[model samples]
Target: MAQAQDMIRLQDVTFAYEYGDPVLEGVSFCIPEGESRVIMGQSGSGKSTILKLLLGLYKPISGEVYIDDEPIGPCSEQHLGDVRKKMGMVFQDGALFDSLTVGENVGFYLIEHENLTIEEVEERVRQVLKVVRLEESLIDKMPEELSGGMQRRVAIARALLATAPKIMLYDEPTTGLDPESATQVLRLMHQLTRERNIATIVVTHQFLDALAIADKFILIDKGVVAFDGSLADLKDSEDKRVTSFLEPFRASLRLMEERRFV
Candidate 1:
């Protein structure tokens, strides 16, 4: 049974693509309310697969997935939709609509799902945009008119519009940005987690960014969890797989230090 504080839980879940080998095997993890988990792995290592499973985009072949302590494997589409309403997802790309104004994009879900007047939706949009530190003036501009960081912030705002999500799933939220821009996005994520008490799961290869927002760390290797613990444990891990996965980051930092003294 899930405790009241547990917002997301997966118990011995397994999944595979159609006609493909297993992508996940006997995986289990839990994220409590107001906490953040970072999932890191190489390409095709089932990092994003975990996010999909949580969203019910892909159901597990075996075991159970629980959202807000409710089992989702047997849920109907309508029920899944209800579960999804408590969650928000930000994709690798901002995934904003180029055709819509920033305001329209931010308030899109509320307009479609809730019985809010245009004025009400616009007010709510402004509030979320403020949370992302975006100005109200950008609301009238098209997506193409904004910078990449602005677009990503807009995406975050959009995700928060419908309801105050209990969970936020970010798939490489800081990908394809300058370090400064990436830091800005990471800071926003940190702020949201702290201020809104939202449980967050970030799937990314960005080691530094992941460290910045993660309260717990998970490293997946070949469809299984290779390591799962606090960031301190990750740094101290002497496991072969963990060491091998971290070697590149360690080398990069060493090179930076060498260059600094040169």
Candidate 2:
């Protein structure tokens, strides 16, 4: 069911590749404002496909994909870019430009698409990097010089700087980070959602840390929403598919039943 305040919506959205079977069928979900929705599933379970649809990179074969009440699925490419300005995407691999400095990567969009000067772009870049807790001095550093967690934070800074997006789409945002770094990233995500009132959609398979911060969880199984609800609802679920997926997350929960978590 869609909500009145949903920043992103997919209503009965169905899609398929050329000459391929359906990747997603009748998928419906919503991410309301100021909420963090984590999407988890096995590889190739249509998780990333949903992100692409939301980005207007691929139009669904049927139904609609709406962002900010705008049906972007059928919008023209010229118009799509305008609609896309309301959202930002963080790829799984921190898709930074290896050749460019952190500042260049973060300011690339505004530099190319907008008429901003170097000083204006740099100001915006500094602001967003600070929001991501990065030093302004690192602006000139290349992506290769940064650690994995630093690179991810840079990627997030780039996303946040892009048009001050109302909705954030993260594809494996915390992958390949050390445990401490991953926890920091998850906590930052939670902070961003609550403090900035951004609608966040995170697609990740490793969701133990995510469980600690996410407001809702959606498990996609075999191209369908196998489960969608709060953590309590998830724990109470009797569905075998849901329970099977929860096994690992539940195990981590039991490890430290004594001390209070930070």
After TM-score superposition, the amount by which residue 230's alpha carbon in candidate 1 deviates from its true location, in angstroms, is 1.2
TM-scores for every candidate against the unseen true structure: 0.94, 0.94
Residue-level lDDT tens digits of model 1 in 72-138 = 9999998898899999899999999999999999999999988989999999998888889998989
Clashes of each: 0, 0
State the lDDT of candidate 2 residue by residue for 1-262, as single tens digits. 5667889888988899889999998899888889988999889999999999999888899989999878896689999988888888999999999999999999988898889999999999999998888899999999999989889998888888876889988999888999878877777788888888889999998777667668889999988899889877888999998999888667666553221122
- State which candidate has the highest lDDT: 1
lDDT of 2 at 230: 86
- Angstrom error of the Cα, residue 100, model 2: value is 1.0
